[model samples]
Target: MEEYKKRIVKTIQFIDNNLDTELSLEKVAEIAAYSPFHFHRIFRMITDETVQNYITRKRIEKSAFYLALRKNLTVKDIYHQFGFSNHSAFNKTFKKYYGKSPSEFRKLAPENFHKIQNKESKNGQIDTVFDQYICNIENLLNWRNMNLKIKVTELQEMNLAAVMSLGIANVEPSYNILIDWAKTKRLFPKENVKMLSVYHDSFKVTPPDKVRIHACMLLDEPLKKQEGEVFPETIEAGKFIIGSGEVTLHDFEQCWVSLFLWMKENNYAVRKVFPFEIYHTNFKEHPEGKMLVDFCIPIH
Candidate 1:
């Protein structure tokens, strides 16, 4: 089962990286090293979604991210970038999922509205929305003001043993699983082991309860065999913008938001790779109960 899951995860990663291209079921099945018929059933059984559904949903979610954050890109540009054939199909599918046209969704995004307000306020408009979103943005900016250091660096490919968690609340449990697995493998004395949490979905685009996170430990060498729910994965070598700081649980979301804001301010385009955090010290053991981490965002 672990081996099967490892192949499925590889297929998912491939699909995520190649979202802009055509992703046929047979092609993805081959990635999992399974016959198309059997792969389809197994994928659905494990992921609780059909392969095509997963592909479409991911495309739509990514498109939605572009719509909300990359306001400069027109709806046509986004749809085409995500491999949609035409405006009609894209709009229809997007509306079905979001209950709004792409334009409407973008217009309704609080972050976009906040930016617009900032521009207008400079011209004496001064309108404001006293909502939770405003508070969140302010908190993010406050955290950014803490002199968070960001640097661009290249990383070599990393081998990881990971356990997948479905939501933020389950992340700790996932880490526990990895920790125990590491102990059994005698990979403890974790002072040298790199612990990371890979974000598979953007919290801004996906619901908090539905987000996917992978709790991973850097492996010195690839595992000889899979163990239960833990599986082997790799983070390909790439250039990344890393934000390093000590952050509390309450400031975690703000840290990510601030990093993206920094990326935008610096005119950096995001790569298809998932962003992740590398922990230097566990919050549970910190004097101030803060996690010392480096949030790494891949860039083009």
Candidate 2:
């Protein structure tokens, strides 16, 4: 079961990386080294959506992200970029999910699209409502009080053995499990091993209860076999904007928000890859109960 899940995760990562290309069931199943029929059934069982539905939904969500935040991209440019055959099809699908046409959504979503409710009035009063409620991304600068040291640097590729944790509430337990596995495998040394949590979905896009993350331990080399739910993954070498600081639990969100604001202020474009954290100190052992961490976002 663990090995099966690992394969599915690998395929999901492949799908995310190649959203602009053709992704048939056969092609995706090959990534998992599974027969298409079996892969389809397993995928539905695990992710609760058919392969095509998942692909379409992801494409729509990505398109929505661009429409809301990337003002430089026109509606036509976005639709074509996400692999839609034509504008008509893209509009129809987008409206079915978001209850608004692409242009209408673009007009309304300034900072975050998820906050936009589907309660448009008959008399264009929705514009007034949106104006009152929209959060300006510039306001995120308020988090500067956290005094995070942010920098842009190149990161080497890494190999990891990871355990999936669904929802924020389950993160600690997943990490505990991963640590125990490492102990049994003699992967830990006298010094603290590097631990990381990779975000596979955006908090702004997915519901908090349904968000997916991986609790991972950096590996010197790939593991020979899957142990329990732990499986190997690799983070590609890339340029990243990183925010490093000592933060309490309450400070995590603010740190992330500030990093994104910093990225925007410095004119950096985000790459379509997972953002992650590297833990340098365990909060439980710190005198002030603060964890030293580095939050890294891949950039184009």
Candidate 3:
């Protein structure tokens, strides 16, 4: 694909990974590796609708899915969950696209789900043009309901020096960069170094510019950096909730989401330490395109 097309694809994937977060144009542009003004023009020319319109449409569609499948969650909860500011705002836009109020649609959702899924506008227009979410509603809900094995353990503090990155990392370009740097420096030895990452922000909570993701190696000793900053930080000693399973790179976001949900249900409070991951093996060397990873989040 051409550069702009590649960037647009990445932007769409970013939206998928962060549907619960605020997706401003500037934030989405960062994922595409483009300036905000330039990316907006290119996106509009290529996608027709502006970026804001696209995000709003996708959110509303996902909201519809939530309304149908998540019976326990209230409409108000689903409204805010999809990032709408309030009921009035969600209702007005929802009616424009779905041609019914939120409650009206919810009441009819069970018997008329097929109709809702195939719903269209009066002028034969697409209620929302989408390449993914509309087509995969069942799979999305099923994945959310997955059961994963977890463990709670207490561990001592760890010291790490990482090459931190700021961007939408669903594809983990930052991990690639850090591994390349390690290869040049002969870091992360089989016995001497551990490959780990200290995630300083939640993809669902932190702003794109302020996210702190450190693609790091366990250091035997603190060493001076040759060029970029190497941060020395502590992974505090505490109890932790660990979600472990054989998973591919694609499963990282959902895995974390599930773990946090598990924590809430189990009544474990999140301790204010940046969560980190421990890889049983490197991704490049894994034969199945999957690896054993212990996703460790500190807890009280």
Candidate 4:
């Protein structure tokens, strides 16, 4: 495994050295001395992305620097230089990876660059490299040490498909099962569905992993539960303070500890509902598995 990892690092360095060339998995596998057939699996296991995805991501990362630094180059020239055959292909891939087109990125480049630098270092900070490292550490501590208080409100009715589970450790499995069920039922929405993680754990003394979690959705009130008759639970709606951080479900205890501490420090009361998590993005997209989830706890 160490040998395979070293080979992957070397292959990635080669790709970095020759991003302008026509690179493919077969070629990369050859560089790594691994079979082309087994290359994708190795890449996925080691990097959590397919070889093609990795290449595209690297291309986008490099292009981001160019978008800021290179003014004379047209998007077309950029695409051609990056080995993308046409502008449209380049535009599509850029949008998919960066959520913005090349032209759009170029237009916003200067302002975005300054804004990012400033916002990232509003506190007395040195360079962006150090600022980012400090921010990450601060966020991690905040996610672990912040206390949370509970409040109540009346929630508007919603239509949703969900998986209901008792213990917090079951949250991940329940969430995956609900997603799978949504896929099987063809209920996954492209643009509108506000994926939610609702919680209701009355017993305060329960261990963090043993706390309950319900992977749910807030749907239009009129739609009824059809295939799976998970309970039509009502979530009281009101102004509830929520804190979010980038952490995995397996490390959820840290977040909970933070929330409890925050609540205690602030003199806020705790509600019975288990704090729920909404996974907005898994870090599978990045080489670093920096997964981010928002923990919504009903607080006073």
lDDT of 4 at 15: 75
lDDT of 2: 0.79
Local distance difference test scores for all models: 0.79, 0.79, 0.68, 0.57
Candidate 4 TM-score, true structure as reference: 0.42
Location of the lowest summed lDDT over 10 successive residues in candidate 4? 125-134
The per-prediction tally of clashing pairs is 0, 0, 0, 21
TM-score of 2: 0.78
Q: Residues 113-167, candidate 4: write the lDDT tens digits.
A: 3222211235543122211222353474554554322333444434455655545
Model 1 stretches astray by more than 4 angstroms: 1-4, 18-45, 69-74, 106-131, 134-139, 222-228
lDDT of 1 by residue, 1-300 (tens): 767777777788788888889999989999989999999999988777899988897898788777766766899999999999999999988876666687887877635433321112354532322235445666767768784788999999988998887668889998998899889988976666789999888765555555779999998997666578787878889999999988887777667777888888788888868899998887888878998899999987
What's the true lDDT of residue 167 in model 2? 70
Please give each candidate's TM-score: 0.77, 0.78, 0.49, 0.42
Off by over 4 Å in 4: 1-159, 202-204, 207-210, 221-223, 272-274
Worst 10 residues of 2 by lDDT: 126-135
Q: State how far residue 170 of model 4 sits from its true place (Å).
A: 3.6
lDDT of 2 by residue, 1-300 (tens): 666777877778788788899999999999999999999999988777798988887788788778766777889999999999999999888877666788888887765443444344685332212333233554546455445888899999999998887678878988888888888888875376899999987665554654689999998887766677787778899999999988887777767767876777788888867899999988998888999899999998
lDDT of 1 at 295: 93
Q: lDDT: which is higher, 1 or 4?
A: 1
Quote the positional error of residue 1 for candidate 3 in Å.
Answer: 29
